[model samples]
Target: MPKVLVQFAHPAFSRSRVHRVLLKNCKQLEGVTVNDLYEQYPDLYIDVKREQELLLSHDILVLQHPFYWYSGPAIIKQWLDLVLEYNWAYGPKGYALLGKKMINAITCGSGHHAYTSEGHHQFPVSQFLLPFRQTALLCRMDYMPPFIVYGTHRMQQDAIEEEGLVYADILSGLASGRIRPEHYGGLEIINSLGHGAMS
Candidate 1:
């Protein structure tokens, strides 16, 4: 089984109902590790060597965070800046993360339509994630399509639960080698994991 590490980063985790549910479900799985970035580094003092060692040990890396300003929070950017160094994650002699798999688990308050071409954002959310995608490429990791939970602000209890279940199943599937390679894309709720359109 793949050792999946979820790098969870939420500034106001106590106030997040949606992400709380998402994290709760995924945390129960056997081989999945939920590393709360905020709880670990409240002051954003990231341990680059420690983070690098965690990456080296895990087969799958999940970056779970709230979509702040159409991107990740400051801590995630800081983590990437300090942990994913030039000589360790890339460069001529570096390829320690070559075969690992990565994906972002983002929770957004906006509706799906709001991130389209004719919508307020005027483009797809995937289009805005090129830096992340290309960064994975630079490190030679298999960057899977992001796992998104949209419309979090208006979702009811049942809707939130359903999304949480799907999130759990996706992590479970990835760890157990059940989710296929072709299924990895900018998938909303991992529709490829056989849970129907939970988006």
Candidate 2:
């Protein structure tokens, strides 16, 4: 089984409905390390060496957070800026993260249709995630399609729990090698695999 690391970031976790459930599911699984950035670095100070070490030890990296302003929370950007160093993560001598796999696990308050070109956001969620893809590419990591939970604002408790199960199953699949990164080609989101598309 591949070791998985979940870099979770949420500025206001106490008031979060979707992320709390997702975090609970992730915590229950084995071989999945949930690194709560806000919880760990309340001061917003990231430990570069420790973060790099965590990356080096894990085979798959999952950036799990809420879709805030069409991007990740502040801590995620802070983590990326501080942990992914030039000489270690992406420069000539930066082969530390090469061949690793990465994916985003995000929740959007709006419905999936809102991300379409004709909708309110006026662009697909993928378009807003280009920077993440590019970062993975620069670090020589295989970037998989994101795992998204849309319409979170209107989701009831049962629906949220169902999504949590799906999230847990996805993590389990990734850890057990049942879900291959290459199988995600041409897919817009990793959630498709949960809908009987993985086979």
Candidate 3:
């Protein structure tokens, strides 16, 4: 089984409706380590070394968070800045994450259409996440299409719960090696594999 690390960043999990529900079952998986950035670094002081070590110990990395203003929470950006060092994650000797895989699990306040050019947000959700993809690329990691929960504010309670359960299954699959990196190649929404493969 692959060791998976789920790095969750939520500026306000206490008052969150979608993110809190989505995180309900993430820590229950055996080989999946759930690291809540805000919970750990409430003071905004992230231990760079420890974070790098966690990355080295995991085969797959999941960045789970709510999409705020088309970007991740402040802590995630800070973590990325401090933990992913030039000599360790990118530069000449930065091969620590070369073959590892990365996936983004995000919740958007608007529906899928809101991300389109014809919609309110102006561009596709994928466009908003390109920076994350590029970061993984620079580190030589395999970045997968993100698992998304669209229309967060519009989703019914049952739908929100179902999405949360599906997220748990996604993490479980990654940890158990049931979900291959190639399986994400053609998927636009990673959650589509929720039913058949996740179960």
**Over 4 Å off, model 1:** 185-189, 192-199
User: For residues 1-199, could you state the per-residue lDDT of candidate 3 as single tens digits?
Assistant: 8998999999888888888877777777889998999899999999998899999999999999999889998998999999999888989875789999998999999998888889999899999999999999999999988999999888888898888888888888888888886876789888998754645
- Per lDDT, the best of the predicted structures is 2
lDDT of 3 at 39: 90
TM-score of 3: 0.96
Number of colliding residue pairs in model 1: 1
TM-scores for all predictions: 0.93, 0.96, 0.96
Give the C-alpha miss distance for residue 194 in model 3, angstroms: 2.4
Error of 3 at 80 (Å): 0.6
Greater-TM-score candidate between 1 and 3: 3
Pitting candidate 1 against candidate 3, the one with the higher lDDT is 3
Off by over 4 Å in 2: 195-199
| lDDT by residue for model 1 (85-159), tens | 987899987888999988988988888898887888887788877788898989999888888887898999899
Candidate 2: the clashing residue pairs are none
Worst 10 residues of 3 by lDDT: 190-199
